[model samples]
Target chain A: MKTLLMTISRDLKVAYRNPADVINPLVFFVIVISLFPLGISPSADVLVGIAPGVIWVAALLSCLLSFELMFRSDYEDGSLEQMTFGSGPFILVIMGKIVSHWIMTGLPLALLSPLLGMMLFVPPPGLTALMLSLLLATPTLSLLGSVGAGLTVGLRKGGVLVAILVLPLFVPVLILATAMVQTGIQGGDYTGHMLWLGALLAIATGISPLATSAAVRISLSH
Target chain B: MLNVRNLTCIRDERVLFENLSFSLGAGEALRVEGSNGTGKTTLLRILAGLYEDYEGEVDWALDEFPLYVGHKPGVKDLLTATENLTWLSALQEGQVAPDAVRAALAQVNLRGFEDVSCGSMSEGQRKRVNLARLYLTRASAWILDEPFSAIDVSGIAALEERMNDHVLAGGLLLLITHQQLQLDCAVRSLRLGV
Candidate 1:
């Protein structure tokens, strides 16, 4: 527990030291969502109908944009190698890093969802649903993204490969999140949607750390 | 004791090394030497448990985890030198006080540069910051990959003294380096590619 906390705090310190790292994804989220109104349709009705899917997809892409850097610095500077042979289990340190990274990037993106939803003309009732779905769903993306990041940490051009490897895995959460917000916008029961998103989050929390650890070890082989 | 038998590593349709074996007991140092692309670093990494796609066995008997210092400094660019050492060393053993980090930096001759970010430091300085961990731990075994490379003449000499002291103090040293060192202990050499 001490080791995990130390790792989490250390990662937080590192993330904070470079404010751009924490802010880049948020900027991407805003810019991408902002562009939707410019490029697609400015009609509030069309925007309202597509708001949930647009916001969720934009969040997913912004999260993906930040995934490559998640472990790239550690892998480059050899910190990952040290942690692998360190006393604490490598999986736990990875989990700690992921959680702290989410706190930096995912949490804020979720918090900003309401304003982005309002810009998209989403109903006021769906604002809470958007925030809640993003809160539960982005961490799942981070968890799933870690596996792709770890697998490609050693590759020369890992950015595109990470998206290819991880975006397919993100479809279920995107669907469930959009479904919940759409249902909320329609004044229908969305309890089942939250339950499904919760189930996905639970499973991702359970398996991703282990998969990421194994992927990191395997990356050293190539 | 650290023992290996018939280790073989093949990377991308090319055999880096095969049919290799060696052993190290307490109070000993093993120097891995080879030409470029001959698997010296690969062997050291195998010893350090960083890479594990080989067909062999690594049997180590130690009280705690071993230390591995690789080619890169492992210091975060956004973190100050002191912060990098204090935190990275914590992953190995908990409760790494700030004083220990300072002491380790001093041992590596990096006293005044503690607060500076690693991104701005020179290559040799960054390497020194990484080497400070050697002063921070009491681990039984050390696996260093090219510990002497990218270091200055005096830095190399100081590191030799540290290696001698570690082995003399009964700690095992498994390292890869092209620059030979003068040590006051039994030093074993393994030359890959025959």
Candidate 2:
């Protein structure tokens, strides 16, 4: 737990020191969210109806955009190698990275979802549900995205490849999160969708870190 | 103390080395001398427990892990020299005192550059930053792959002196270097011919 916290703190420090890293994803989220209103129907009702999916998709893409930067920089600089050979298990190191990634990218996206959703004309009640569902679901995104990030850490042009590899895995989260918001908007009980989101988060948290460590080991071997 | 017997390494369908055997007792130094492409780095990796494709038995009589420093200095370009050392110290399970880190950097003639981003430093300077890490960790064994590739003459002498001190303090050193290193110690040289 101490090593995990240290890794997370190191990552957070790195993230905070680099302004462009934080701003790029936030800008991407805003720009992607803004496009929906201009490209889709101008009717407020139609825009509000589609806001949940739009916000979720934007958040997913933003998270995916930041995932490549998670392990690649450390791997290239040899910190990843040090962690692998260090006292702690590599999976624990990976878990720390995932937690830091959530704190930096996922948590910020969750916090900003309401404003992004509002831009799409999402009503207040649905915006609340969207934020709640994203809060539960984005850590799962960070965890699963880390596996792809680890697998492609050493490859040239790994960023686009990571997006291609991880975005498909996010479909269930996207569907369930948006469904929860839509159900809330329709005055229906959203407990079932929230429950499914929680299950996905649980499963992802349980399995992805170990898989990511294996993938990182393989990548380093080559 | 460290022991390795029957170590083999294979890379890219080519056997780099096979049936390699060596051991180092406390306060002993082993220098791996080899031509280019002779698998010195790969052997170092195997010894450092980073590569497991080889068949070998390794035993150590120490509580600390062996420190491996590869050709790359492993310092992040964006981080200041101090931050780099701090993160490395944390990863290695050592408490890195700022004063100690600063002293190490000054010993390497990198004073006043601790707050500078490593990307701005010269190649020799970057190598110095990596050498400073040796002063920060208390690992019993050091596996250094090409530790003197781009360092200046003065830096090389300082590094040799540091290695000599480490050996004097009952530390084991496994170094892969192309250039000849002058040191006063019980040195064992292993040459790999391709």
Candidate 3:
């Protein structure tokens, strides 16, 4: 646990030191949300109807953009190799990375979703639930995206390939996340959606890191 | 403290090397000399436990883990030298003291540059920062691929001194270097043919 915390803290420090990396994804999120307003009618009803999908998609893409840098930079610089040889299990190291990525990308997206949600004319009651759903959902995206990022870490053009590999896996997440928001919007009890989201988070937290570590080992091989 | 028996490495439908066997104990080093196309780095990777595709068994009795420094320095370009070292230390063991990082950097002649971002440093300077880990960690085995390539004369001499000290202190060193490396300790040479 100590090692995990230290790794996460270090990653956070690195992410913080480079403000542009953090700002770029946030900008992407805002820009993507703005496009929907221009592309569709400005009617509050239509915008509110589609806001859930738009926010989820933007969040997914933003997470994907940051995922590639997670292990690729470490792998290229030999830090990943050292971690593999270190006393800690490689999976644990990957988990720490996933968690740090969530704190860096997912947490911010969740916090910013409320403002974006307001812009999309989502009902005030639904806005809180939308933020909650994003809070639970984006971390799962980071974890799942990590597996794809690890698999493609060493490839020359792995950026878009990572998106291609991960988006299919994200379909279920997209379905459940938007459903949760849509449920809240429709004045339905969101407990079931929240429960399902929690289950997905649990499954992702349990399985993704181990799979990512294995994929990373394979990718690092010449 | 290290033993390998009949190591065979095959990649891309071609046998890079076959039936290779060697061992290194305390006070000894292995210099894997080979032609350009030969798999010196690949062999080093297999020995370092990073690549398991090769057919071989590497047995080590050392308490501490082996440190593998590849061609790339592996320092994050965006991170300062101190930050990189601290993070690497945490990943390997736990939190390392600031003094230890400072001492290691000074050993590699990077005293004042510890706060500088690695991206702005010269290639040789960056290599020195990477090599500083050897001084910081108590790893018993060091597997370095081409440690001297692209380094200046002073850097090479400093690295050779560190390698000698490591061997003298009962640590093992395995290096792949084309440049002539002069050391006080006995070195076992394994030359590969194209």
For all predicted structures, in order, the TM-scores are 0.96, 0.95, 0.95
- Name the docking class for model 2: medium
Error of 3 at B174 (Å): 0.7
Candidate 1 chain A minimal-lDDT segment of 10 residues: A80-89
Q: Which residue pairs in candidate 3 collide?
A: A77-B74, B1-B25
Candidates 1 and 2, the one with greater TM-score: 1
Model 1 spans with C-alpha error above 4 angstroms: B12-14
Off by over 4 Å in 2: none
- Interface Cα root-mean-square deviation for all models: 1.3, 1.7, 1.7
For every candidate in turn, the CA RMSD to the true structure comes to: 1.5, 1.8, 1.7
Worst 10 residues of 1 chain B by lDDT: B44-53
Candidate 2 per-residue C-alpha lDDT over A1-222 given as tens digits, one digit per residue, 9 for 90 to 100: 777988888788788778689779989998988887788777889898888888888898888889888888888777788787666667888999999999988888889988887777777888889889989999999999999999999898898899889989999998899889998777778889888999999999899998999989888766
State in Å the error of residue B19, model 3: 1.0
lDDT of 1 at B96: 90
Best by TM-score: 1
Candidate 3 chain A worst ten-residue window by lDDT: A81-90
- Candidate 3, residues B1-194, lDDT tens digits: the string is 88888888888888988887777888788898889878888888888777889887788887767888898787888888888877776566555898999998898888899899998999888888888888877788899998787788987898898899999988888999989889999898998765
User: For each candidate, what is the lDDT?
Assistant: 0.88, 0.85, 0.86
lDDT of candidate 2 over B117-185, digit per residue (tens): 998999888888877888877887898988888888888998999999999899999998877789898
Best by DockQ: 1
